[model samples]
Target: MKKAIGLFLLTINILLMSCANANQIKKGDMLFKITFAQGFSNDTLSLCLNSCRIVYNRILSSDNTSDGITDLQISVFKKNDSFSAKIFQGKEISCQADIRETIKIEIVLNGSSQSFTIDTKQGAYLSIEKNGNDLSLRQTKEQVLYD
Candidate 1:
């Protein structure tokens, strides 16, 4: 009977240890991706995109955002990289002539803004969102929304 009880206790201890380990997240690590428009004119648009990428790196490195992670794991891809802007029917509109050529950026966390360029060009834009429950709260300094 004592041997059986000892085996049961050991099983429980192992299960508890596994559960505890699962709750911990590594520091300075992130999974994200950024894609840019293609066939850029080596001009402002490209510049902006490059600037945005730099800003993105800064944002990712910030402990104020990443919960104290030092290294970032981001996957980047460039699609067709060709898009067109037009003034049609007295209205300004944009279209992707090479629909395959476009930009896409995604990150693990959703909140705050990030900047990046068109690739090697100096154009920039901000990425912002209010993350709900999908984001962990331990690393945040302000009140987060959960829904």
Candidate 2:
């Protein structure tokens, strides 16, 4: 029993220390750079479509908009780097592209926002929902929809 109690206390201490090391984010700034492959200069989706894809990263904004992000934009391709990317249209829609992109998302819960980083480019999906006075962030390969 003594050993069990010691283990539990150690676990809690480790978690607290890790959380303290996380970055404190606000509405704007703190950009995460993503690199995608490109082919030509004329510009065509087909060039990268076969090799790369896009994913939506939704994070809660301090602006209080329902969508969280107010003015969201990403430049996947750079003339110098030859990195190309595309953002899906409409609400909660994505290209279903396959790549290894990691981005953090924030969700509003209990009148506040909590951030979570996910790798949608690596075929990852996330669902945030309220579960009895608490919030849950689930990451899986399955589709997650919100009302």
Candidate 3:
């Protein structure tokens, strides 16, 4: 009976240790969805506009990949002006930045080691930039429900 109890205790300890390690190396994903519309204005100008949409994903499966926790920042610029928004899952988030643009969208992630540039309609703009230590929000699926 003593030997059986000792084996059971050892097995339980090993299982708990495995779960804790798994939690430390959590993997996450996020998705950014943006929509743009022309602000109410009397100016009737047809500007040469280009619209493009792109998606990005990152996976942190190991300690090396998790190093992006510190330099996670999001920023947006439009018409040489600055704006802000909230892009975090909750209060525990490290940092978040949001910008609305009338011409372009730029994204930098993983401490800006990887980045992207996008152009939007001249009359409107939309973009979503996400960065963090955890991958809570990721682009699991995307569909163009309408055009």
Give the alpha carbon lDDT tens digit for every residue of 76-123 in model 3.
223223232222331122212333333334332343333233332222
Q: Model 1, 108-147: lDDT tens per residue? A: 2223333322221222222232223222212222222322
Stretches of model 3 off by over 4 angstroms after superposition? 26-147
Candidate 1 — worst ten consecutive residues by lDDT sum? 38-47
Q: Note the Cα lDDT for every prediction shown.
A: 0.30, 0.38, 0.30
TM-score of each: 0.21, 0.29, 0.21
In candidate 3, position 50 carries an lDDT of: 19
How far is 77's C-alpha from truth in model 2 (Å)? 13
Clash count for each candidate, listed in order shown:
27, 3, 7
User: Residue 110, candidate 3: how far off, in angstroms?
Assistant: 26
Off by over 4 Å in 1: 27-147
